[model samples]
Target: MSNFDYDLFVIGGGSGGVRAGRLAAELGAKVAIAEEYRVGGTCVIRGCVPKKLLVYGSRYSSAFADARNFGWTSDSLRFDWPTLIGNVRREVDRLNGVYTRTLEKAGVRIILDRAVLDDPHTVRLANGDAPISAKTILVATGGHPMIPKLPGSEHLISSNECFQLEELPASIAIVGAGYIGMEFASIFAGLGVQVTVIHRGDQVLRNFDADLRDGLAEAMRKRGIDIRINTETAGIEKVDGGYRVHFKRGDSLHAGLVMAATGRLPNTMGLGLDEAGVDLGWNGHVVVDEFSRSSVGNIYAVGDVTDRVNLTPVAIHEATAFAETVFNDQATPVDHMMIPTAVFSDPEIGTVGLSEESAREMGHVVDIYKIVFRPLRYTLAGRDEKMLMKLVVDMASDKVLGCHILGPDAAEIVQMAAIALKMGATKVQFDMTMALHPSAAEELVTLRHKWEAPTPMAGSDAAA
Candidate 1:
């Protein structure tokens, strides 16, 4: 008989932890998962799932306007924030049930309370009667959004609170130009709210290709969202009409709400990682090896808590790789290279492989192929919105080092492109493929010009 209560004790019901626990149990090992809140964690409860639903809700204004240009008649458009929020909550609740039931059906015990490390191999539950022992313990507690320490910060909201508001604000000032901030800006603007975005950096989506970033910024400006770059918030105060956001340079703006999406930190505080001898990074993320094993041999971590690749699919992939290595005797290590990612802001963004700057810095002589033109749909609709398609190719090997797109369905197109990039597809191969005529994506295959190497690309200053 086994010496422990279970083979695995997973502390987190997030995507990574739950996937690990379920797969381990299915592999015939005893498993138990403990979660303090809802089982779906950030993605389902308050992150991607709810955020995407809001993105969809916010797009109807454009659709309504576009329909008229397409010769389709429509009724007066109205947006009900409460109704949308209520439905999104229902969907989240249903997903929570599904996650819980999945674990139970897999014969994995589910503990609906917080669990922390008592030692390398012991888990102490906040509300349970006794400590649980397991051969291995996995920490996948995920992360929470953080705001800067400014005067009257208590009045500011984070992404978590944005989901729970009773009513939509008439206007909002968002600090931080990351994907989260930009996404909220797009959503609020689409819903007819006055939106202002403030960022200390000169550009939004700082990690993306330069052209894509600037294109998105121009698009947001064209949509009437005011973007103030290289600015910092000094304080906030409740005012007569709403709130006043004071800037460091003695400027201010009045809005009904202020949101901070600066960044997220791992949810590892007070979980006893130190006492268990698990090493963490300066920013409090758990430090793990290639196999996702922590400093302590019997303890492991995955997902945002590890801070390697914070996307939900990457977390899920890491968990599957963890289970296979530990339980199936496959000794698998997750391949994070060339992982495709998307930003769901207005006009969207999808990218895979290295950015052109990174590729060049790595000492690759690159060939750039790019085009910016109004999509065919906008031609008939009489809109000036532009779509950008770019490819960064390693000239030496002829391999497509990166694919970046900015426009409607950019995320969808990039997801398919990721598969080809992962397979080491070459620029020649891309050219050999037939174009699906009259599609925004067909531009991917039809580009003919190779941009000269000596000509500095626009927006490259921010690339570094």
Candidate 2:
């Protein structure tokens, strides 16, 4: 019918690429997806899935400690790293197979080789096969961890290599305060490892609500985590049994492990996108329009590789929108606003919609309703942990603008909250909804008064 090796050729068999390939096939397009390493990409292979498993594994110590208050007993509690890591690896391998099979079942050919653009319509493979030409090309190559070029940085492990570590370190010094670094800090600390979080910024989680950032820092410190803010790393030098991490200001920290969770950059190196005339942003991400069409009409990209939002779900959403727009003849623009996100750190954090700062900066007269109270679960365990619930509302329209939660089940609670917020539910609607008794989430609907900062004591610095 047409002169092309396939209708669509997708590079990167990650979640977004897989979804696009599968949907395009269902819409009657011949598709072939290429992956160099594994089918599940970063999230399933090295990121969210494996990391969440480690978070669950690390949390057992707290559960074991709380069992006493719950009237349960274990004479001896021990954790085996090999067993947990082995099982996690097996699960990851199984998921990789599952993803591979899903594409096969969807009638999309899965190519297990590195692929790059030979031209706008041709895909060159690393296997030395003849180049395959497609009517359209989609890139969903995802991203990789970014590390600074410092002396002896080779000794530092990234978030990607954490799962594959042969053994957990006795102590770890994390070099960033992002969600990734903080999550690992919680994990290592929960598992009785000495964890020190070093950050150059004044606080952790820079773009998060200030209260939540400060609250999390205090909670982590109370758990014996040494959070060194305003500290800069000069370089790293190997020592006898560990590493001596040089500080910028004439000091050093010694630890069994040093990790750089600085940030992530799109995986766009040597893919030949730039030379092919597909536009890339200054950050080296593929610049695409609302429907994911790149500068070249037949080229499209979706996922972290495009750097819009950079979440796995957001990538999948973009991919679906791409398939809908290109294949189904329906014009769909990605709505990049009001995405719910979570940090699975100790105590956890979940937030959606605009932050209070964002709402205020956008010239909305806002009402900030907040409550911080110890959860009922902590009462019996004698764990003095507090749960935070805050709602930012637009006074003029009574529309709920933001929802933020910090504490246990924060991710789950905010997921349900996001649905209501997405539906444009108002503050009055939240109030009209009945509160579930004795639940942390009930506080969201029941909160009535605006929060006011406590006045400084007469002799305090603020008063002075």
Candidate 3:
């Protein structure tokens, strides 16, 4: 055995773990990362990369239909599901190789085995007989999809399993209405699958502004997705050729395939977290402080394992901040404010900062501005699609509280607004900026009317 095993031992070769290991090694620390699965983890391997590719592939269906209205003619289009799946798999393999090489280039030793914490400072590899010692340990195992207990849920597929399907179904019934569920609904709808989305909640995307959520539901419905809100899946069964999904909202639905996109839970089972004196939340997520330091001083946790913002970018940010503070002695904390996020539905949704309802609940007098109009390109193309833009501002300070968009390139456009919000830009500053004519983004700077204002207090109440 080598005299020095490692200075930092990171479990789970995910975005946060890989980043932290590389950065620590670059700073002259002996770092090693252990991962039993693919090095690129969920985002590059199965989650974000493949999911977006499917979303892109599926969108061609609608594009082909919309082309006719744009004065274009084409023969009947055919989709080869296996070919698309093969291409996506190839891309994921290339990324996995890149991630592997990156760690070696950064002087990080890679251990291809599950890591079990023997102590706060020691980790034992599941495949190896020897135990590795380190000064600091990090848990970044991330999360796994949660499939609820239904009578015949075993017959249902998961988000992870969806990518490996050899053939695309003609129709599908999806359970849940979170981001994952809605994203899949949009993807399948675009791929020409008759999609039925059943959710147990009153509205989809419960975290987003109610207006945007409702608008997105309406848009998806218009695109031919059967959205069943406040609905519950009673059971599933194997039918003659496919699966039969029995659901109850106000009615029932039968589909070819039953998919559960309910949500994801942390992958913390059998990791020996309790044995190492680490505390976990009720849902099995490791508890950590602002700097991602666990209950055990020498142990740290980040990524989906912490149950913090589950976005890959957020985990990367947390990892970078943790490494800077712990190794470089730089006292930096991650700022969750104005963290822009996107939902890759048919009409993409993007937002930064607080929602209108959240702003009002925070005791701010909000001035809401909204614009719903078709873009110039759509106008020329003779398409019926309309884009929605909303701005929430503090009436007293004129500070821009939030920005939201639902339309094409919404993710790309909202990123710029996120930067402005991060820099503390106000409504006046946004309004004063020159507009880009005939562009969808120009709507941000040209909104002339306020949608609502907080009610003023009466004289007696104000005096009191």
Candidate 4:
């Protein structure tokens, strides 16, 4: 290994790559990380950080609207789009510098060029640049926004580009109903934009609990977002000042801007994975084992490139586990199950473990406990927003299989529930725990009645 130029070579200086590279270097291994883009990757540069900033900016609009109800009076309110965008860009740039400094402080060699695997142990940088060699190579190229191939798809902007818009559009038509799509919808709708969401699926968040799904849809609709479910975008054409979005549902909508939040694909293109013997999945995600090892014996992959969960925290966990496995000689594996996640959409959604539908599908007799009520804060503000909490339990084992929440601060509350679920807390254990009065989180442990019966398995394949 001493003869190799680097003990570990990381492609993509994203969350997982940076963590793995820095940790491996800290463990006395010669490490190098190559990134074609910014050091902080998607979460910092575009996805999480900027999105949250926009969400924060958009929330002020509602705050002002609801302020009058709370005895606070103000004249006409104004929002300067450039001011917010500039501030967010400055913050992102500062964070990017911080990530760079952190890597440098950890003695991880940082290369600012795209990397292509020349072989199992060698990677060639972009241009006719020199190739670097390492004993072990890790691919964490993350993912890119997947633009669907519609007739005039090129006319549509993506969520990535949407963040950098100079001026906020008066009306925006967002295509897709996933987290990203729904989040942008909430942001624009809150910001006084005439927002319309076109989703091909029957439900917005298909993976979340059904109760939360219905709750979020209702909340967004009440907020004045025109949500057209089971609708497909056929094409787009330039109209007067705005664009006409033709749909398969026999209707066309006009909007000043169109955003495509369809989904993201693994950023494996031009990486020379085939040339390096790394196998990719059907969706182009790099196939990796529990240990994050790719098909190439000396190479490994993690993060969005693997398309496993595709969350920043999951990537960080995998990176730490990768570091431990390689440098510390610990046989650690990333336990993806029970990974908690949150959507920052209005009336945010949070969940951990299995949904009732999924648990029953897995042959468990499940009992669902749920509650929906207006929070105490809304009473004072004269707002009608409702808080929803649910717990899915395996009846046979009495173990809490899942927890879901839809309300204000749902993310913060669900995180605590995630810890309990991680520790294998059962419904009885939750019941035994005392409730924190006047708190929405307490509902998780205080739900007394069984809300629904065991969901019958779909079709006649229950026995099979």
lDDT of 1 by residue, 185-225 (tens): 99889989999999999899887889888999999999999
Model 1 regions lying over 4 Å from their true place = 453-464
Please rank every candidate by lDDT, starting with the best.
Answer: 2, 1, 4, 3
Model 4 Cα lDDT, one tens digit per residue, 363-418: 99988887777777677677778777889999999999999999889898889889
Candidate 4 versus the native: TM-score? 0.96
Per-residue lDDT over 91-175 for candidate 3, one digit per residue giving the tens place of the 0 to 100 score: 9999999999999999999998999988887889898768988988989999999998998999889899889898888899999
Using TM-score as the measure, name the better of candidate 3 and candidate 4.
Answer: 4
How does residue 353 of candidate 1 score in lDDT? Answer: 89
Clashing pairs in 1: none
Can you give the TM-score per candidate against the true fold?
Answer: 0.96, 0.97, 0.95, 0.96
How big is the positional error of residue 66 in model 2, measured in Å on the Cα after superposition? Answer: 1.1
Ranking by TM-score: 2, 1, 4, 3
Q: What lDDT score belongs to each candidate, Candidate 1 first?
A: 0.91, 0.91, 0.87, 0.89
Return the TM-score for candidate 3, rounded to 2 decimals. Answer: 0.95
lDDT of 4: 0.89
Off by over 4 Å in 4: 452-464
What shift in Å separates residue 298 of candidate 4 from its native position after superposition? 0.8
Point out where model 2 deviates above 4 Å.
455-464
